[model samples]
Target: MSDIAKEIENAKRIIAEQKKRIKDAQKEAAKAESKLRDRQNYILGGALVKLAETDERAVRTIETLLKLVDRPSDRKAFEVFSRLPALSLPPQPAPDTGHE
Candidate 1:
């Protein structure tokens, strides 16, 4: 085989490898983004639950703030929270008696 032909073949192989790597990287990035989104939703749900338990008025304030923002994500979050039923913390256990 001619030297130039071998060089051209090598270049084509390198290009194919690079394309595969790029595709794999893109898929990994999409997965990471999806996981991050799920984590964010969990954290936000937990926080809203806590706020509702602690102070409903605070939740109203957050709703107001969300209304003031123009972001679509914020509006969507507000809608989700609005649909949830009000939550309250369970009553604290009474102080321990002297008896075990």
Candidate 2:
């Protein structure tokens, strides 16, 4: 083969190898993303299940306490607790000034 033709053939071979490598890398990336998504979903589902179970237990405990307490005290306790707002993650406050 002429020198120019040999060079052209070598370039084509390099391009083909590069394309194959790129395709393989893309497949591996897709597989890793799918695995990561599955793990995230499983963790989120488990957290939701745990939160529901805890909420149910809290409600049952509160009901039991109301049953055990007399009406007047139970009403008073309920009023006190009701005064508090629903619990939530509040924004973190800035550090306090040391100046008194």
Candidate 3:
């Protein structure tokens, strides 16, 4: 083969490799983003659970905020949760006084 033809083939191969690398990088980036979203959801769920246990009003505020999401699924989830029974914290025992 001619030197020019060999050079062109090499350039093509390089371009193909770069394209493959770019695709792989994009997939990795998507996976990373998905994992980040999952982690954020876990953290949000934990926070909401704690807030619900501590204060029903705060949980209601979060439900109201969820309605602001443009996604229908978010609103639907909030509605479903609204129908569920409210979380009640366990009653705390009264502190004993030194008199007893």
Candidate 4:
């Protein structure tokens, strides 16, 4: 092939490789963003669970939110909530003061 034709083919190959690299980078970025969102949601869910332990309103809100789960597989994870205890913490035994 002529030198000019060889150069054109090399340029096209380089362009295709760069495009693939760009697409790969975009996919990696999207995956990272999705992971960040998952971590944030997990942290928020933990906070809500702690709040629900002592707050009736939080418990009610959680129950209401659980209703939004439409997937049967996901809904199964929430089945424990149906049998959850009251929001109040159980009474603890009195600590010994040694002054009695």
CA lDDT, every prediction? 0.69, 0.64, 0.70, 0.77
Candidate 4, position 75, lDDT: 60
Which candidate achieves the best lDDT against the true structure?
A: 4
Please provide the root mean square deviation of candidate 2 (C-alpha atoms, Å): 13.9
**Which ten-residue region of model 1 has the weakest summed lDDT?**
82-91
Compose the digit string of candidate 3's lDDT tens values, residues 40-88.
9989977876777678787787666654665544444444453334422
For candidate 1, the TM-score is 0.53
Residue range 1-100, candidate 1, lDDT tens digits: 8999999999999999999999999999999999999999989867875775678786776556555755555444444443444422223445689887
RMSD of candidates 1 onward, in order: 13.1, 13.9, 14.4, 13.3
| lDDT (Cα, 0-100) at 8 in candidate 1 | 98
- Model 3 residue 68 lDDT score: 61
Flag clash pairs in model 1: none
Give RMSD (Å) of candidate 3 vs. truth.
14.4
Whichever of 2 and 3 has more lDDT, that candidate is: 3
| Residue 17 in model 4: lDDT | 100
C-alpha root-mean-square deviation, candidate 1? 13.1
Model 3, residue 48: what's the lDDT? 76
lDDT of 1 at 77: 44
Candidate 3 residue pairs in clash (backbone atoms < 3 Å): none
Candidate 3 positional error at 11, Å: 1.4
For 65-95, candidate 4 gives per-residue lDDT tens digits of 8767766567656655533554323333455
